[model samples]
Each structure stands twice: as structure tokens, then as C-alpha cells.
Target: MSWSDSFLVLVLALAVEAAFGYPGRLYTRIGHPVTWIGRLIKALDRSFNRETWSAGRRRAAGLLALLVLLAVTGLAARSMEFALAATGPIGFCAIAVLASSLLAQRSLHEHVAAVSTGLREHGIEGGRAAVSMIVGRNPQSLDEAGVSRAAIESLAENFSDGIVAPAFWLGIGGPTGAVLYKAANTADSMIGHRTPRHEAFGWAAARFDDLVNLPASRLTALLIVIAAALNRNASPRAALRALFRDARHHRSPNAGWPEAAMAGALGLRLAGPRIYGNVRVEDRWMGDGRADATAQDIDRALVLYRTACTLLFGLALTIPMLIWLIAS
Candidate 1:
């Protein structure tokens, strides 16, 4: 299919996911796409990631495993796309529904907002419980401000990673690209770590995920800045400033952009030092704002997130029209 058609698919998928996220019942009946991908990664790791092998051999095995994963995922997605290609509107809608599963728009909002609700209703204990669900850090280490900041950080990072990246790939490479990206991302999450076992073995998955996520990260940051511009309470100028000043300093190459923008737009400091499980990671701060974030701040961040999502949908719609106009 043409790029225009792919973008149209993206637009419809965004709308469907935003309106009704993958239903819980549907997930119960048949596992979600990511879960399916995760199972495959688990199988590959069990079969190939042998500890006795030299690091070089293991790394080679890792690359080979990643290639196999991508090949299988791409072939399956392309086959489905081909099967649906001749069905006209019905096929388009069906593809869009399948594609919608890849996005996290509605679920991200719900999860982040749950933190605020938990904080407001049940105090620190409630806040920790809710925030723990979304963040990898030790929830017990956080105070009220820390909990709030963690939630906001997760919202910003996930906005780019979970929502924008998938949609961006969908627009560019159709179903094959989107699913293939998801497979790589899942592999990274499962094995792309600095741990002795994963460090060498997961190099390819980690590096490739970082590369594919580059454009979407910047685009997500820009969308957040624009959303800030539209919100009276948000500071678009601060968001833009943070993008230039602090994004690169962040530990992650891509996560910094949206995190910094969200921090500046919301006037909060985020992603400095944190304890993940037992390890203390001393990362650079993202925004030059208040560190004592509150539940109200989380509410504000959700506003920006919602606005950014809307802007993303708008962007998806606009691209197809532009492509059509240029072609004409």
C-alpha cells in the first residue's frame, strides 16, 4: 500500500484506540499482540541465550535471534495486510482495528490519572500503589512529590514510546513496520539490558529500537510543546527551552525529549536520581522547575498528554491530505 493509505490507517487506528482501548474482555479471550510477541521472545531467549557460550558467540546468537524474530513478525503482518488489501473499506476498517491494539493512548491516560485519583483518595499509600503499576522504580522509596514526579515522567516517556512510536511506524511502514517495531521493542524490554547475560546478547535489539524510535521521540516532544502552547496554564516557551537545554543530558537518547518538554511545560523537575529495585541511578534532571510535585501537577500533566495525543491525531490526518494534494 501507498504511504497515504498507511497514514490513513494510522489516523483511524488512533481514533479507535482513543475512543475504546483494547477491551479487557477481548484480551482475556485472546492475548494481546504484545503479549504474543513477548512469548516468542521468551522462547528465543530460553533456546539461544546459553550462558556457557563465550560472550562473542552469545552476541552473535542474539543478533541471529533478533533477525529471526523480525522476519517472522514482518512476514505475518505482511501476509495479513495482503489478505485484507482487496477488501476495500471493510479491509481498511479491519486493519485499523488490528492496528489500534498497538497504541496506548487511552490506557496511558487511564493509568496516569489513576495515580492522581489514588493520591487524592487514599493518600501516600494509595499513590504508591497506583504509581507502582506504571513505573519501574521502587515505589516505597518515593514520598508524595517523588510519586507525583515519577507518574509524570512515566506519562511523558510512555507518550512517546508506547503511543507515538507505534503510530509513526504504522504510518511509515504499514502493519509490517508497526508489528516489527513492536517485536523489537518487546525484545529490548525483555533482554536489552546492561545485565551480564543481556548486555552483549541484546545489543542488536537495544540499538535498533533506539534508532527506530528517534524520529517519533522528537515528534512527540514537538507535539507536547505545541500542546503546551495551546494550554494557558502550560509554558510552551519553557518546554521548547527544555527541549534544547536538557534533552541531550538525559540518560536515554530519546526519552529526554518528551520528559524535558513535559517537565518544562508543567513547571516541574523530573528524572534526576532514582532507585530502581536495589540500584540507584543518578541521571540528570530534565526541567528547571519545582521538584515538589503534587497530585494537581499530575492532573496538569495529563492535560498536556491528552492535548499531545489530539495533536498527534491531527498530524496523522494532515499528512494524508498533504500527500494527496502533492500527488494531484
Candidate 2:
């Protein structure tokens, strides 16, 4: 396909995902790209992560394992890129479908909506269960407010990681960029824990994920700040302040940006100390807003999130056309 045609496909893929998401029938049968990448990451983790190895050796093994992962996934994605170019219109459509599956726009909305609905209908127990599926914290330990806060935090963070990051890469380099990102992200999720088993072996995946996600995560925050400018009880200035102050204090270099931005945008506190399983993490909170968050706050956050996504879509559509015009 031509450059303009390729960009059009990239934009279409984003639109398709934002509108329809991945099809359930396809998910039930062949599964999704993230799932496929997850399986490979799991296999590599199983094979390379041996407790018998020394920490230094395990770290090196981790680096080696990551390279192998990149090589395998990169080849598959590049082959797809070539095949798409060779097959004309059908392949273009096929690649757009494949790229759409790599994004999480539709599923994110559904998942966050489920959490809010569970809270409204099933009370604390339901909210906790729904929130637990998305967050790392111990669900049973959370109160109604905590559950709501957790759900909102997950929405903001994953909005950046799962949605914006993939789309940014896809827009830049199409399917190969999108697939490579998914592989790195999957590896990070699978092995990026600080536990004894993964602390050394998962180092590369964690760091690489951080590096690749750096730009998108910040852009996600900026988008949220812009969205906050258009809403009430939400301050764009506060969002910017929180993003600069609290974003640096969070555990993950990337996650804190959007999470802090969303927190400030919604006027709610997030990411404070929480219990994950038996462990209590003394993490700093994001935002200088309300401490007692509610389901209503979640609704507000979702509004801001949806608006940010729309603005992002507009920018994605416009920037390329501008470039095309300039070049011509």
C-alpha cells in the first residue's frame, strides 16, 4: 500500500477498535494477539526462569530470553507486513483487523463499566470482585471507596498502556510496531514482578516495557489534562500539577503519568498505600483531591477518559494528513 493508504489503514484500525473492539466469536475461537503473545511469554518464562541459577546469571538469562522473544515476534510481524503488502486490498483489511485486536479501547470500556455496574448493583462484594480482576490489590481488603478508586486507577493506567501505547506504535510502523509492543508488554506483565523468582529474570522485560511506554504514557496524561480543561469540578492546571509532582512518585515510571493525571482531572486521590496479597506497599498517593472516592467519581473519570480518547483520535487523524500535505 502507499504511505497515505497505510496511514488510512492505521486510522481505520483505531476507529474499528474504538467502535467495535475485537469480536467475541473470534476471541472464543482463535483468541487475540495479546493472548498469543502471552502464551509465548509464559513459555519463555517457564523455560528460562530457573531458581537454581544465581541472580546475575538469571539476569543475563533474562536478557537472552527477551532477545529471543523479540526475534521471534519481530519475524512474525514483519512477515505479516510483507504479506499484507503482497495481497492487496484483502491483506490491508486483514492487517487492519489484526491491528484493531491489538488495541483495548472497546474491552476497556466494558471492563470499567462492569466494575461500576457491579458496585452499583452488587455492593462492596461485587465491586471488589470486579475490581480485583483488573488490579493487583487484595480485593477483599478494599472498602466500597477503595474498590471504586482501584477501578478508576486501573482504567487510567491501562488506558495508556493497553490503548494509547499500542496505537501510537501502530501509527508509527503499522503491524510490526504494534506486535513488538504487545510482546514487550506481555513479557512485562508475565515476569515483571519484584518477587524473588522474577526480580532478576524479569528485569529486562520490566525496563524495556518502561522505555517503550514512556512517550504514550505521558501523552495519555496530556490528553487527560486537555479533557479536564473542558469539564467541571476537574482542573487542567491541577492535572498538570499532579502529573509533574505525583507522577514521579509512583512505582512505575510510566503508569503514574496517566493515573496521576486522571486523579487530578477527576479531583480524586489515587495510588496510595495498598495491600497486594499479604504484602503492604507504602506507595505515595496521586492528586491532591478527595480521599473518599465513590462510584460517581468513577463515572466522572470515565467521562474524562472517553473525551481524551476522542481528542487523541482527532490528533491521530490530523497529524498524518498534515504531514502528507507538507510533503506534497
Candidate 3:
């Protein structure tokens, strides 16, 4: 497809996702594209990530599996794009709908908002239950502040993973690029860890996922900072400062960018040491701000998230025209 077609598809996708998120009925009926991607990864993982194999062998097999994953995911997405394009301009709308289904801006907002509501309605326990849906950390171990911080951190990090990254790839590479990213991300989540079982086998998936997310993660931090600057009460300078100071200390090369930006924007400390299941991870804090994060702070983060998403969407629209202008 042409660059104009790709950009238009992305803009439509962003608009559709911002307006009407993928419906629960649709999910219940067919599950999500990620779920479909997850199934494929699992199948490949089961076949290739064999425990009986030597670590080196497993690693090599894992790399092979990733190649297979990329090929299949790209082909599937291309077929869908082609089928949609067959419908002409109406096909572009169909492509937009398909692409939008892969993004999670509205859904992420709703999920994080639920954490706030749960905290307000039923205290820490309610918040814990709500947050457990989105975060991998054990909810039973969390206090009110922990729950709130987890919700906000997840919000900031996922804004890049779930929305900006996909949109960035789509704007540049179309629906196929978006889906391929989703596939990579899914593999990382499922297998990308330092755990012995997955350490060798998941290395390629983890690294590939991180590589793709690199630009979007930093871009997301910038978007958040710009959004905070636009807001009267938020501190864009703090966000920028926090990015330089704290983002480097984060274990994940990308996650810290948005997390620090968020922490600074909201004037709350996030990341730091946290327990996932029974394991206590000794991570550096993202911001030099108050640690007493609350549901109210979560609500504030959601507002910032919305603003950042809008700004990123606007950026997506501008990029193609700018490229065209320069080319012309």
C-alpha cells in the first residue's frame, strides 16, 4: 500500500480505538488478536523450547522459533490487509477496524480507572483485585499505596507497549508491521524472563521485543512530557529531568522512560522495589517524589495518559504529510 494509505489507516485506527474500543462481545466471541498470537507462540515454544535440549541448542531453536513466528505473523497480517484492501476505500475502513483492534488505549484507560473505582468503593482489597487483572504482581501482598503505584506504573508502561509502539509500526509499516509487533510483544510476555526455564529459549523473543519497543518507549516519554506541559498543574521539566536521572536505572531499557515521565508528571515515586508473586525485585525508583501514591493519583495519571495518547495520534497524522512534503 501507499504511504498515504498506511497513514490514513492508522489515523482511522486511532480514531476508532479512541472513540469505540474493541467490544467485549467481540472478544468473547473470537478472543483477541493477541490471544491468537499467544496461541501461536505457545505452540512454537512447546515445540522448540525443549527442556531436554542443551541450553545452547534451546537458544538456537528459540531463535528459529522467533523467525517462524515473524514469518507467520507477517503473512497473516498481510493476507488480512490484502483482503481488506480488496474492498477499496471501504476496505481501508475495514483495515482500520482490524488495526484498531490491536491497540489498547481506551481499554487501558478503563482498566486503570477500574483500579481507582475499586479503591474508592472497597478499599485496598478492591483495588488489589482490580489491579491484579492488569499486573503480574501478586495482589495478596499489596497495600493501598502499592496497589495504586502498580496501577499507575502499568498505565505508563503499557501506553508504550499497547498503543504507541503498535501505532508507530503501523504508521511506518502498515497493519502487517503492527501485528508483527504484537506477536513479538506477546512472545516476550509469555517467555521473556530470566527464569531458568525460559532464560535461554526466550532470549531472542525478549531481545527482539525490546529492540522494537526502543523508539516508541522514548517517544512515549516525550509525548507524556509534552502532554504534562500542556496541562496547567503538571510539571514537564520534572518529567524531562526524571527521564534523564531515573530512566537509566530501570532494568528494562524502555519501561523507565514512560514510568519516570509519569512519576515526575504526577509527583509520585514509582517502580522501586516491588514483589512479583513471591520474588522481591530490587529495582531503582523512577522519580524522586512522594511514595504515597493513591487512587486519586491514579486518576490523575489516567488524564495524562489520555492526553499523551491524543498527542501521539496527532503525531502519527503529521508524520506522513511531513514525509510527503519533503519528498514533493
Tens-digit lDDT track of model 2 for 22-92: 88998899988888888888898899889999999999999999999989999999898888868988988
Q: Is 1 or 3 the stronger prediction by lDDT?
A: 1
For model 2, the superposed segments whose C-alpha errors exceed 4 Å read: 1-6
Question: lDDT score, residue 256, model 3?
Answer: 97
TM-score of each: 0.99, 0.97, 0.98
Judge candidate 3 at residue 155 and give its lDDT: 99
Q: The CA-based lDDT of model 2 is what?
A: 0.88
How far out, in Å, is residue 226 in model 1?
0.5
- Candidate 1 vs candidate 2, lDDT winner: 1
* lDDT for model 3: 0.92
The deviation in Å at residue 8 for candidate 3 is 1.0
Candidate 1, residues 222-320, lDDT tens digits: the string is 999999999999999999998899999998899999999999999889999999999999999999999999999999999999989999999999999
In order, candidate lDDTs are 0.94, 0.88, 0.92
Model 2, position 74: C-alpha lDDT score: 90
Sorted by lDDT (best first), the order is 1, 3, 2
Best by TM-score: 1
lDDT of model 3, residue 327: 85
Order the candidate numbers by TM-score, best to worst: 1, 3, 2
In model 3, the worst 10-residue window by lDDT is: 1-10
User: Residues 1-328, candidate 3, lDDT per residue (tens digit)?
Assistant: 8777788889999999989999989999999999999999889988888898999998999899999999999998999889889988888888999999989989999999999999999998899999999999989988999999999999999999999999989988899989999999999999988888899999999999989999999999999999999988689999998999999899999999999999999888999998888999999999889999899999899889989988988888897788789889
